[model samples]
Target chain A: MLKATIDAEIFREAIEAISALVPECRLHTAEDGITTRAVDTANVAMIAFTLKKEAFDTFKATKSEIGVDISKMKNIFNMGGKGDLISLELADNAQKMAVSVHGYHYSITLLDTNTIRKDPNSPTINLPGKVVISGEDLNNAIKAAAVISDKIAMGINPKDQTFYMVAEGDTDHIQREFGKDELKSLSPVEARSLFSLDYLRDMGKVMSKATEVEVCLGIDHPVRFSFDIAGGNGHVEYLLAPRIEAD
Target chain B: MLKATIDAEIFREAIEAISALVPECRLHTAEDGITTRAVDTANVAMIAFTLKKEAFDTFKATKSEIGVDISKMKNIFNMGGKGDLISLELADNAQKMAVSVHGYHYSITLLDTNTIRKDPNSPTINLPGKVVISGEDLNNAIKAAAVISDKIAMGINPKDQTFYMVAEGDTDHIQREFGKDELKSLSPVEARSLFSLDYLRDMGKVMSKATEVEVCLGIDHPVRFSFDIAGGNGHVEYLLAPRIEAD
Candidate 1:
């Protein structure tokens, strides 16, 4: 059983982050808050998301795993206006959840968890190099590189103490290097990995609103992005696998 | 010879109005300003547009006809930042037109006049019923109707002194009626005609910015939408052929 009232904007922000990586998820609800860990079908990306109870205006829940259709949540919120108070209620052992926002009532049938893959375990990896930068700057670099190639390489240049993102096209390449002056903070360590722009582009939009995002990198390994949302009451992490660079 | 400088925004508004109907246009430039009239490939709709000299920051020109690729202009302008003054130059009988906005210089090859359709003659028809309403309201009605069906009927009822727009779908219909309180002014003349919503939706976007739009209608005849752009220095008219309303 679960009942909660949350600001529509904050709810939208949370749902958008989950929807970016998967169409559906197994949401774990507890007295403290809700959390979800899921990987893309192709196993190219993974998202670990949490919305703490403090982020909601009122919250109550028992330990339970709820199957949520992320796309359906998007459609439901689209009908709501800004600043609306969204109320969500689920009875014990019920297959349907009741949602009300701005005079509209919607009964959404929960997805069958048996059909969705079990929640993935967050992998443990060592990434020594790290940099914190404004989300806008990170998204801008991703957009600029996408204009030249479908793959982007991000790394920390130890010698210059800079973070750089570069994309190589068949005949041309674009690069953006963030020096100490532009970065919020940086650990001058060696790191470089190539990633597909398709996944980064989707994740970039969600991160663009964050004030600061910590990007962790490793040599020839997956990259991780960590950021806070809902005024720091909620948190999100994105882990993207590196692509093989063909010579 | 022709050389002129205009605000990027005003120029975009005028081109967008024309491009909604045709992709290419034979632009006629004179000392007074520029004018273009073209019909869509299917000839189901027509656009009559004019941009006076007063709308430009600097203007000078001799009588000439220039072929303009509307879609190409869209691409060029996409590179220019807002508030940038666009400079257009064409030497006497030159095949290339120089367009400079911001720090970029683009030389566009003019399409062959012979390859484009000749100027379409404007048909003279009497449309007695008229209503003047805010462009926002007009566009809103068009959008609301589009959700119901592909065809919309616009009319002025003599008995109620009201303007009505209605659309009928397979099993549902939506109707919006503007009384004296809602419309700026309405002519109490019996007029009704059905038009394809595809054309209206494109035209609606351009009209949404105008302060006021004048709508003229006739019995089983075409509907005419007239509005001003560039702060009254320019004008645009869209005449869409009526579609048969099947039972």
Candidate 2:
């Protein structure tokens, strides 16, 4: 059993963050919050999202797991007005979830968890390089890179104490460097990785709304992006596997 | 020889109006202004556009005809900022038209006039039923109708002095009525015609920017939409052949 009322904007942000990586997810709900961890079909990217009870205007739930169609949720949320309160309710063992927003009632059938892939265990890896920057800056670099190439390389220069993104094209390239003055913080350890622009573009759009995002990296390792949402009451993390650099 | 300087927005509007009907057109240039009349490949619709000298900041030309690719022009204009001035220059007998906007110079090779379809002569048909309404209102009705069906029926109710648009779907229908209070003017002649939504949707988008759009209709006849652009110095008329209404 679960019942919750959340601001439409916050709910939209949360759902969009997950939908950027996966079409559906098994969401775990408890008295304190809800969380989901899922990987894209290609297994090239993973997204983990958590929304605390504090993010909601009203919240009540028993520990439970339910399958959610993130894409459908996105469509329903698209119809809602900003700042509107969206109420969600599900009876114990029910297969359909009820969502009401702006006088419109949506009854969505929950996907069967048995048909979904079991949640993967969070992998442990050592990523020494880290940087915190405004989400707009990160997204801007992603967009600029996309204009020139289908892949982007992100790295940290320890000596320069700067983070940089580069996309090389057939005859030209685009590069953007964020120095200490431009970033909120940086722990510059030498690290570099190449990533596919296809995934980054979607992730960038969702991350752009965040005020600040923490990016973690390592040599030839997957990149991790962490950001706060719902005024810091909710959190989202994206882990994208690196693409082999073709010299 | 032709040389003209016009506001980017006015040029964009003219190009968009022409592009809605045909991909390329034989544009006629005179000392006084420029004009184009072209029918879509399917010959189901035709567009006539005229831009008077008053619409341009400066205008000079001889009697000439040149084929223009409307889609290419749209791309070049997309780079311009609002209120920017776009200049066009064509030397006598030159194959390329020079366009300069925002300090960028582009030489576009003109299509051969012989390769383009000859301008269609405006058909003579009496459309007695007339209604002058806000462009936005007319466009809104077109959009609403499109949501339900691929064709719309427009008619004027003589006794009630109302112009109505109706679209029927498999199981439902949507109708919008514009009474005298909602229209700039109305000529209540008993008239009704069915038209394909595909053509109206594109035309509606362009007409939506006009303050007023004059719609002329007749039973079993084509519909004619007339509107002013470029601050009334320019005029555009769209004539769409009606689709047979299967009982």
Candidate 3:
């Protein structure tokens, strides 16, 4: 059993983060908060999200697991205005959840948790390079690179003390570099990886609203993006596998 | 020979007006200004436009009839920034039109005048009922009606002293009424005609920017919309045939 009320904008941000990589997730609700961890069908991206009870205006819950259709939730919330307050209620062992927002009430059938894949184990890896930068700057660079190629190469130049994104198209290339002055912080150990713009584009749109995003990378390894939401009451992480760079 | 420079925004409005009904037009350039009149292929709608020399920053031209690809011109101008100035040049008897905006230069091949349809003669018709309204308000009603049905009936109620638009969908309906208080002026004549929403949606987008639009109507007759652009230096008129209204 669970009941909670959250700001529409913050809820939208949380759902968007999960929907970016997967269409659905098995959400675990507990007394302290709620969490979801899932990987994309292609196994190319993984997302783990946590929203503390403190993030909601009012919260009460018992340890329970429920399946959530992330994509469908996104569509329903779209009808809500920015200043709206969204309320959700679920009874113990119920197959449907009640949602109310902006005077409209809807009953959404929850997917059976038994049908959902078991939560994936968080992979362990050592990423030596890290940089913290404004989300707007990171999103802007992703958009610029997308215009030039289907994939983008993001890396840290230890000697130059900078983070750069480069896209090379047929007979054309685009690059954006950010020095220490532009980044909040940087661990400038040599790191470079090529990633498909398709994945980054979706993730970038959600992260764009974040004030600061910590990007972790290693040589030809998966890139990890971490950010806080709900004014620090929530956290999200996105891990995207690298694409092979063919010279 | 023609050489002129105009604000990108003003040029965009002009192109959008022409492109609304037809993709190409035989543009008539003279010492005074430029003009074009074209009817859609189905001959259900007609557009006549004129831009005066005073509207441009610099203007110089001789009597010439050139075929302009309206849709293409719209695409080219999309590259220009809001504050950018668009410069156009065409040498006497040249086949190419040089367009420069924001330091980028492009040479567009002018269409053969003989390949384009002759300018349609403006038809003479008497539309007694008339109303003058703010473009934003008029366009808003059109948009609202589009969601309800494929056709809209606009009319003036002499007894009520109001102008109104009504759309009846299969299972839904929408109506917006503007009494004398909401409209700038009204003729208050009993006039009503059904029109396809497809055409109005495009025309409404262009007219939405105009300060005021003059609408002339008649029972079971065509609707005529007139508005000024380029700060009164230019004028545009749209005439659309009424669609058959069935009970």
Assess each prediction's global lDDT (C-alpha) against the native. 0.90, 0.91, 0.90
Give me the displacement of residue A75 in model 1, in angstroms. 1.5
- Please list the residue runs of candidate 2 whose C-alpha ends up more than 4 Å from where it truly belongs after superposition: A1-247
Considering just the first chain, candidate 3 attains a TM-score of 0.98
Residue B17 accuracy (lDDT) in model 1: 88
Cα RMSD, each candidate: 9.0, 8.9, 8.6
Using alpha carbons, what is the TM-score of model 3? 0.56
Per-residue lDDT value at A24 in model 3: 86
Candidate 3, residue A66: how far the Cα is off, in Å:
0.7
Q: List the residue pairs that clash in candidate 2.
A: none
- Candidate 3 segments exceeding 4 Å error: B1-247
Using lDDT as the measure, name the better of candidate 1 and candidate 2.
Answer: 2
Write candidate 1's Cα lDDT for B1-247 as tens digits. Answer: 7899999998888888888888999999999999999999999999999999999999999999988889867644644457989898999999878776653345667888889999999999899999998999989999998988899999999899999999999999999999999888888999999999999999999899988999999999999999999999999999999999789
Candidate 2 at B113: error in angstroms?
Answer: 0.2
TM-score of chain B of each: 0.98, 0.99, 0.98
Residue B70, model 1: lDDT of 91
- Runs of candidate 1 with Cα error greater than 4 angstroms are B1-247
| Candidate 2 second chain TM | 0.99
